[model samples]
Target: MSTVSVREFSYNPSAVLARVEKGEAIQVTRHGNVIAILSPAGSPMERYAHLVAQGKIKLKPVTAAERHSMPHYEVPEDVDPVALLLAEREEDDR
Candidate 1:
C-alpha cells in the first residue's frame, strides 16, 4: 500500500495507475487527508465468494426438474381465507 497526493497523482497518473494495475493498493490524498483508494478489480464471482464460503448463499438456482420432484404441502380442502372473511363481514352487517 502507498499514498499519493492529489497534485502528485495529477502530474503522473499513469505511474500510479500502473502500480494499481499490478495489484498494489494506492491511497489518494488531498491536503494530506486520504480521499480514495485504487486497486485491482476482482473477478465477478469474488463478489459472492464470502457468502458462498459461509454457506449462506447458493451458487446455482434450484433446477426446474428438482423443484417439480419435491413433494409440496397441500392446503386443507375448502379453506378459502377470502371466503371466510367475506362470510364474517356478512355476519357483521346483520
Candidate 2:
C-alpha cells in the first residue's frame, strides 16, 4: 500500500495511477485524514468469477472455433465514412 497526499495526487495523477495499476493499493489523504483508496479495476472474468463460484451464474468457456464464427464486415475502398456521417448530421438538422 502507498500513501499520497491529495496535493501530490492532483499534481501527478499518472504516477499514482501507475502504482495502482501494478496491483498496489493507494491511500489518498487530505488534511492528514484518509479520504480514498485507489485500486485497479479487475478484468471482466475476475469480476464475474465470484458469482460463478457462488452458483449464481453459469459461464461457458468459448472454443477457438466458436470465437471465430461471428460475422465480419469489410469497408469498401471508395467509402468516405466521415463525409457520410457529416452528411447524415446535416440531414438531421433540416
Candidate 3:
C-alpha cells in the first residue's frame, strides 16, 4: 500500500493509474481524511457464472398465481385481455 496526496495523484494521473492497474491499493484523502479507494472493476459475467455454479441463483418457476399477480397495463376499457395477449404472442412469434 502507498499513500499519495490528491495533488500528486492529479498531477501524475497516469503514474497513479499504473499503480492501481497493478493492484496496488490507494487512499484518496482530503484534509488528512481518507475519502475513496481505487480497485479493479468486477466482471458481471464471471460473477453470474460463479453464482450459477454455486447453485445460489435459481430460475423463478412459473405458476397460475404468478400470472395473476402480474399488473395489467391500462388501456381503453373496451380493450379485451384475450385480444391483447394474442397480439403480444403474435408479435413475439415474428
Candidate with top TM-score is 1
Full-model lDDT for every candidate: 0.70, 0.70, 0.62
Off by over 4 Å in 1: 43-94
Clashing pairs in 3: none
Better of 1 and 2 by TM-score: 1
- Reference-based lDDT, residue 52, model 2: 48
Model 2 Cα displacement at 66 (Å)?
Answer: 43
* Model 2: colliding residue pairs: none
- Window of ten residues with lowest summed lDDT in model 3: 43-52
True-structure lDDT of candidate 1:
0.70
Model 2: weakest 10-residue lDDT segment is 44-53
How do the residues 1-94 of candidate 2 rate in per-residue lDDT, one tens digit apiece? 4679999999999999998888766667788756666767874455554454455765565688987995454547798856777877899999
lDDT per residue as tens, model 3, 1-94? 3567788778998988788777665555566655555544552233343443344663343599997998677667799967998998999999
